[model samples]
Target: TDKPAHARTSNLNEELGQVDTILSDKTGTLTCNSMEFIKCSVGGTAYGRGITEVERALARRKESTLPQKLGADYARLSGEKTFVKGFNFKDERIMDGNWVNEPRANVIQKFLQLLAICHTALPEIDEETGNISYEAESPDEAAFVIAAREFGFEFYERTQTSISLREFDPTSAKKVERSYQLLDVLEFNSTRKRMSVIVRDAKGKLLLLCKGADRLVNLNIMSAHAYNSDLFSLLPRHFISCPFSLEMKSAAIKAFKTSVAQQITDAKALLTSSSETPETLALIIDGKSLTYALEDDVKDLFLELAIGCASVICCRSSPKQKAQVTQMVKVKTGSTTLAVGDGANDVGMIQEADIGIGISGVEGMQAVMSSDIAIAQFRYLERLLLVHGHWCYRRISSMICYFFYKNIVFGFTLFFFEMYASFSGQAVYNDWFLSLYNVFFTSLPVIALGVFDQDVSSRYCLKFSLLYQEGVQNVLFSWVRIFGWVFNGLLSSVIIFFFCVGAMDHQAFRNSGEVVGLEILGATMYTCVVWVVNCQMALSISYFTYIQHLFIWGSIVLWYLFLMAYGAINPTISTTAFQVFIEACAPAPSFWMLTLLALGTSLLPYFVFASIQMRFFPMYHQMIQWIKADGQSNDPEYCQVVRQRSLRHTTVGYTARFEASKHFEEFSEIKSH
Candidate 1:
């Protein structure tokens, strides 16, 4: 009976929430996984917000209270708030910096056609279903074509006779009749990283424009023109170094190579038209690099500012960089973490997380099956902390404190009586009665507390308070409360013991027995024994709000009622160990008031613990105190804000997720065997 009750709790995730550090992935985790080509910069004039732009515009409708959303390329686009100084996007007309070009209005039609007709994957449309399935190897390539259709531009069909051909000129030209010419085509290869085509007009005039890896494209044009390689210089570093890849990393590499092989063909004597022998030009296209150049230019400020910009590190990155970015967050922050992802690339980072939550209804099947806690709504993220995360910590700590208080009352009397029986020939209560009370009352309430656990998110969210760690301090004092209870019970029991002994004249009932006392005094000792056994049963309800609040209170009550109605208040149990029977009536009325005062004194520990918490942990205590506050009060709005803000950070840590995921992985490891 002196042993403490066992604790039942959610895995210790709440502790992790107290940690100050948190790491997160960038791709899909920070940046949306869906990438779109909304803007392309030429000269200094920039275009498009990209797909992220469209999303921000849409999200603004929901969060209109916040500052206006800004574009990522705003540094180069906005002329007024520009940070580029002399380096503007559109300053000296089309070739100058400091302006934004409306690509959506002008050559967008041609741009769509180029992305679609020149691309490999054909959009699958169901005639009977009227459903169009646009399957592409790469999401970026697929996104471009979708935007094209969304804008009412279709990839147009072209015929050989419709347009005349022209050769490469120094400047780029839009898609037009003169755009197609019997010009040389530089094949696109994955290894080469670019694609190009040249054309010559009737007058033998040449023009060229190429799109591919910025470095390779610039190199080839400069090689042909014998122009300064400055434009081709550092092209990869500045324009293409941003990591990417959502899925199909290796397939993308293969697709890059296959597309190039399709373009190679021989040329005839006139060297014009697809009908002419394409053998010479096609032969060595796979490994060809028409021109090459290298340069080093670093963005000194960008690297420093990148600390705040949420840039991702993508070591061994795929076409998508989400996992690599997640890895970077772990190394940098060094804290237990939770990652929510729904993609194959997320698998590496998901497994790496302290809590990995894979969304079932979004993206891929692999991620859903990999997560620890799969919920329908990501917004539950807030509630999860409120209930199962940090709030769980608060509750567990409170319960432990409550148990300590109960321990005090238990220890003083249980030990005192046990010691008395062993040393002084005084066994007050029958051991059988003591065992019955322990079984019925002591454990039921604690077990019920564990079984009926519920979510508490709606109840609390607290900001960091001056008394943030009051829960821990309260736990230490709670033990003191329990001791106070035990001391009071011991004091009460001792009074009864001595009073019965002094008043009685001993009369031995058996040759081996020395009784509690002789005659009526012995009768008083018997009454005291019955009262103390029942007191222990009643006191178990201390932590509960009311008797009914305890899950097993009814069961404890039934046991007590059974004892009062049928059990004889005697030490001997030959035939009446549990059979309720009335003892002979008392010689005098019981001193009920004395027992009440003594029991109440034992509850002094509860008053002390509450007072300390009320004084020191005023924020939380005040919250409990204001449980009666109504909305009609003058401070309704202010109180609501205070309450809501309090819960924002008070989450039970993701400890359950960490442990569950760990065990799951270990289980899977064994199963894989």
Candidate 2:
């Protein structure tokens, strides 16, 4: 199979098939990090009805409708808007229009003002066109500044002590100038979801402006309550239950019910209210709350709120917290975890995960260096995990099983031959032939199988992501299956040895003189071992392509050639011995008859087992378990049946969950339907 263009590492490819949980960073990885201020919240109302360039393009193609649905404000911002490259502000409601006549114009003005004053973006004006751009540490900060510029509050200059903005004043119906002394900037970080700036206006009024994800604000409120240990202790137990529990206890429990209901009502009121707090307020939270939420006592409550709330965002989370969260999910669920990001901050979580994916994006190469796999974009992760991941897991597992089987069959044949010789410890075949058997004859076929064999097509793998759960659940490779292969190898060895010995010991070889008889017996037994080992290609379920077939059959041809060469080169025996060996190894009627008998005796048991499995047990996995007696206890048949039923039920449940995964839907167009 061809590797995807985005993938960087093949070393951990198989890990993709086993991922049960994915922890992803929001910026750069999920959002492209090329921020465009497409929308904003003002006076408890979201304004600015536009989406980003990528979103618009995706929407236009109908490849993804999610971005379009997300831009629900599109209708309001659709008319007569000024166009900006890379920023899709095509709505007239919030672009280039005089703010004097707009509804809630005061709130809109304050919102624009907030965007302009935010930290870290510095303006750069083109000498020829007079168009302004921003230079900032974070793209998101630049986006906010750009949005403010397009909305008529242009942040044009900043110095060590002050900031200046050109604004459209509604009262005067004219552009006005404003300057503020820079008081302080509270920068954004993982733990602090929001950033705040304190500025002294021309009038010397000290004002603090803040913005961030809503979840951050909600967590802050919880943290404030948690800070007061007395108040938190008074609250009912049901609200802050176990970390894993999502269910809320009965409302009949008055203390818990009242507290939760009141908090919900207060949150709703704050979100719905039109008035700005002190000036114009956007409902938001800060990182202090997140820090508090991470503590043992309050972590469960935080998780409850975080999971239950649909639009909550954890702002300003520290990289340590990110890794901790991933580790927590892995420990709680006992599932494989995958973490993806593109920045240095993301390295911790990426390393903590079972499989880490890093985007080689604008953030830097730190994350990519730490990750198991690297990709150009987050979207490519779909094909990487679904198609390539499945192929690697299946191929590698089958290769290992077959490797063990081949070695056991060859090794145990020697063991049986030793027993036949009454433990004299003499070699059955030449040392050179025995050494070359695995390296030259058997190696290429299994290598080809591991690299090229596919039980299901890439299309099918993508369509049924539920199949990936097999790797995570360890359905194919287990102790039982390994032991089962060993048992089969032993059985085949017994059949091959007995059949070959029986034929060689008959009157034909015995009637010859002692020396010639021993030589013929050795040659006949060696042929039986070679033929039995080669017959494994027939029983294997791996897909055999042109290369695989060439290698498998080519090995048999090479073995025959080696035998002819060995007869001519050996100095220990005379010409007559060589002639006798040739006669025994010839493709004569009796030689072929003995070969067929050996093959049939060695393979018949497996053929019958395979037929029964195919006919009665259509499920390949169940057939494997039945062969191995997996999951059975030292109990009655009824108990074993009950255990098997339970196992089946669990598998069905995991399959259903995997089929319904949102990540699968996001990547697989076929599964989406």
RMSD for each of the candidates = 18.7, 12.9
lDDT of each: 0.38, 0.61
Segments of candidate 2 deviating more than 4 angstroms:
1-11, 34-36, 44-79, 85-94, 102-107, 158-162, 176-183, 198-207, 213-316, 331-334, 506-518, 572-583, 620-673
Write the residue-wise lDDT of candidate 1 on 531-637 in tens digits: 44344434432234453354344654564465555454443542333332233222123333433444444344545655685565544434533442543224657
Kindly list the per-residue Cα lDDT of model 2 for residues 366-387, writing each as its tens digit: 9888987887766676667667
TM-score of each: 0.50, 0.72
TM match of model 1 to true structure: 0.50
* Candidate 1 residue spans exceeding 4 A from truth: 1-21, 26-45, 48-114, 117-122, 129-131, 135-142, 150-336, 404-408, 422-439, 447-556, 564-581, 584-595, 615-621, 624-673
Best by TM-score: 2
